[model samples]
Every structure is written in C-alpha cells, then in structure tokens.
Target: MSNIKIFSGSSHQDLSQKVAEHLGLELGKVVTKKFSNKETCVEIGESVRGEDVYIIQSGCGEINDNLMELLIMISACKIASASRVTAVIPCFPYARQDKKDKKSASRAPISAKLVANMLSVSGADHIITMDLHASQIQGFFDIPVDNLYAEPAVLQWIKEHVPDWKASIIVSPDAGGTERVTSITDCLNVEFALIHKVRKKANEIDRMVLVGDVKDRVAILIDDMADTCGTICHAADKLISAGANKVYAILTHGIFSGPAISRINNACFEAIVVTNSIPQEKNVKQSTKIQVIDISMFLAEAIRRTHNGESVSYLFNHVPL
Candidate 1:
C-alpha cells in the first residue's frame, strides 16, 4: 500500500537492502547504536504516523542485540502512532530451546513465547519468519503470523544446479526432519530417504543408520537448521557407506556453531547448501564446499505481498513458473 514503510535493524542489512530493492523503495532511516555499557540504543529518523510499517530484523550474530533492536523498533513504531507493525524476522532467536530438555532447567518454551508476547505488547501486529526450528512454536503467538517455507526457493535452486534431473533422492539427516524432507521431495517429484543416528557419548561421534537405498543416486539432504555438523556428517558417512554416489545438503539456517565447518568439510557430502537466514560466520566463509543460496528474493516478495495485503500462498505454489 502507499502507506507502507519498511525498515531494517543492524542485523541482516544486506538481505534487507535486497528486499527494499525488490519493492522498488528505499529503506526507512533508523540508527541503532550501542551504549558505553554495551546496551542497544535505537532511534527512528523518520515519522511513520498512521502508516503500516514492516521491520526487517533477523536474529543472527549477537542474537540478543538483534532481538533488542527489533523490540525497540516495534516500540518506536507504536509510540510514533503507526497503524500497524510487522516483525519480519527471518531467523527467530531462542527457537532451539522451544522445549525443556532437562529436569533441572526451567521451561524455555515460555521464554520463546515471551518474545512473541513482548512483540505484541510492544505493538507488533503481525510476524513473518521462515523454517522455525519447531513448527509447533507458531502456537506461541496470538497475532496473525505468516510462516514462510524456504522449500520453493531451495527446490528451484536444486532443479537448476543439480546434474541429474530425474534421479535425485531427497534425504532427511535424522528422523525428526522427515516431514521437511518429504515436502521437498513431493515438490520435486522425487523419492525420499531417511537417515537415523544414535548419539553414543557426549562430544563423541554418532553412528548413522540408513532407512532407504541411496546407492548410485543424487542424494539431497534437507534439514531446518545446522548448528553443529555432527548429525549431518554422520549421516553423510552412512550414505557413503551405503554406496551413495554423491550427497548434497539443503539447510535453511546455517548456524555453523563451533567447528561445524571443519566437520562438514571432512564429511562425504559433495556440497552443503544453506540459506542466508543466518549471517554466514567467518569460519563458514572460509569453507570451499559450503554454498550460500540467497533467499533474499523469496523474503523480499513475501514482505512486498505482506505490505500490499496480497496472498502469500501463491509465493509457495511454484517458483515463479
């Protein structure tokens, strides 16, 4: 709409610029600074009174800082009397802790829920995010939320880049990602496979088990996020052992925490493709086989549709024909 205004925080500025470019508009001016005590300080340089504003801020590096910037931006829009505020977070922070894993630890799902509540309370009317760690986390928000999939984008890339067209097999590195892997498989009209892993000891390698034949086929592994390369590396090893000709990976968020890059480099995968949902770390940039597939176009279109009150479902129907 003519009343739409888009802004970006310190986080994911490049992706934000691409989104703004797609909409044929300039990013709204906003200054985000750090205080002497290392606290986040944000200031809106323009007015958005009676306007629908979308704030693009993904929680990547310095996750807490990015989170605070998004919160403060929302608060500023509310105080400026904007008609509506939408938080366009490609990577939602604190998503991994959606459920409590230890008896001694407090429930962090509530913490994740608190983030949604904070945004709503601070005047966020809508949310846009991609490939949440757990799909059930959507229930944490009462406001209208649009959870976009990177599948359309990933599938398009695969169809273009992968060598063999008809013999590709979608793979899930672990049983937990079966649904995600199947979605891609169905879209590509390809058969799918699943790899199972068992963690025998802490900080130790995991043993992998294969559920389907991967031999002499183009194996494609799909997962929502890759924090550590442990599971994926193990899965790749098993796929190789099972006589898989070559393996490729499509991961939504490439967190690449710790020595994940090194681990992935040593694995049997031909290439590890990831989206720019999370900013690529320094270590990731140094890797040769790690490819970054930009989802900026997909994200940009979603933001434009959201601003114009257009249907986002069409964005996922098929990759622009």
Candidate 2:
C-alpha cells in the first residue's frame, strides 16, 4: 500500500475521492487544465517514480477530452519513471463500437480497439473497468484487463429494498443481456425473463416483445448500460403491458443520453437503479425514479487486492452484504 498512488482526472473527481477515502489514503496531487487552444495539459504535483500509479478517469461528459486526458496522464506517469501505470476507467469510452458490425460500410473502424491501442501505446500496464458494453472488448488489448461486475452491488440493493424479492423475476432488456440477467437470477435462486427487441434502424427501437412470463410478478430488467433509455423504456412498457405487476431497471452505467431523462421519467418502471460508474446529468439527478448505487468500495477493494498481489476473482461473486 505504501507504494500505491492514486490520482484522478477531471471527469469524476467525486468518485475518485470516495475511492481514495475507502482505501484510507488521500488522492495524489495532479494538475489538469486546458490551454488557450483547447489542448489538455497535465503535471504531476509530486513524484511517483518507482510507485504503482492508478489513474481514475471515467469516460463520461466530454468523452473525447476525457479519453485524451487519460492517455496523457498515463504517458506522463510513465515518463516520470513510475513502476507501473494502471488506468482505472470506470466507464470505458467508445465501448459500443467494439466491432465492425456493418462490414459493407466503408471506414467502419473498431473504435474500441483503437482506444485499447491508444492506452497501450500511451504506456498503460494494466486496465480496470466496470461492466463494459461488450466483454469481448478485452481481447482488443494485449495487456492485462480486469473487467469487474456490478451485479453483486445491484443484487444486494434488491435484497435490502425490494419486498418479496425472492418472488421477483429478473429480466434482460434484450437478448444481448441474457447472460447478465441470468447471472443475477442464478444468485437469487429466482426465475428470469428476456425481452426481444426489433429495431427499425440504428438507435430506433421498432417493437419489443416479452418472451417469458412476467405476469403479476415484479420484474427487474438488467443491462450493462442504458443509453438514450429507449430499450429500457420500451422494455418496461412491454413488461407492464404483459401483466407484470411492477417493472424496475438496474443498469451498471446510466448513460442517459439524448432524451433519456424524458423517456425514463415517462416510463412504467418503478425505479431505474444505476451505479455511480458514470456521473448523472442534471436532469437524471433530479428524476425521482432514478436511484444511484455507489461502487467506490468495490473499486477500492479491487485496487487493494491488486496492489497486494492478491486474487480479485472473489469480488466477482461476493458482495459486501
């Protein structure tokens, strides 16, 4: 622990502070600012030479800028002779573009792969992130990547807050999240459902249909992220229409982009639970239906285990309940 140094970028300092507090250490002093030409400048306020440095920066709010800042910070730490630099990106940027889904389209770059390349080229020795949009994105990097799950925290929340949780059915907003939903249901020893979505075009959900029984039972929709809230909102509507007694959503990253707040506010969901992996916008913060779960302790424990050369696999299954 003495050789561990944690620093934060401008993206989500509050989360970084909380993580540092959990580890009983203060955040490392690093000055990050912008120049007249809109270029990012970073300077380490103290020496990190021969120390294991962890840079905390979530890929939220001004996505490109945050990515650039993280890359620069990693490069700076390496240049300063840090023993190792680990990028602790809570919300990985460009994760949705993990594949070239449209092969016929020209210039269809796998942006996630490019980001991984940038991190490696920028001198990152390790990568730690939560609930990536696509798990396969880990293969894009040659270095070690720790993909953490937020299911434990979410399951604990359900156990504490929801009455008759044992009777509730876990639901996947789309077939893509079947595995994620199944993992939760398996842990709770409950039944699960899946929603099949038809898309008219990109980002346009044409129709959604519930495949399993949710009738008169509490339904908890689980997904890795909720961007624009279209899938979540539409799935909730379908669940309710299919006779679900109540509908709720639990997403690891609440990306609430573009009309998401309005859609969420008008949805049939009882509550939209999300972790503080990405900071909520003003409208999301004000929404009464949205609930935030802090993941700082989970991340802090991972950092501790990594610094101590201990296995962090236990964190994947056990929640601090």
Local distance difference test, per candidate?
0.83, 0.91
lDDT of 2 by residue, 1-321 (tens): 799899999999999999999999999999999999999999999999999999999999999999999999999999999999999999999998887766447677899999999999999999999998999999999999999999889989999989989999999988889899888899999999988898876678988878899889999989999889988888888888889999889999998889889998888888899999988647566698999999998889889989998998988987642
Worst 10 residues of 2 by lDDT: 99-108
CA RMSD, predictions in order: 2.2, 1.3
Tell me, by lDDT, which candidate is best.
2
Tell me the tens digit of each residue's lDDT in model 1 across 80-179: 9999999999988877767675654664355677787788888899999988888877998898888888888788789888979469788998788998
Estimate candidate 2's alpha-carbon lDDT, on a 0 to 1 scale: 0.91
Name the best candidate (by TM-score). 2
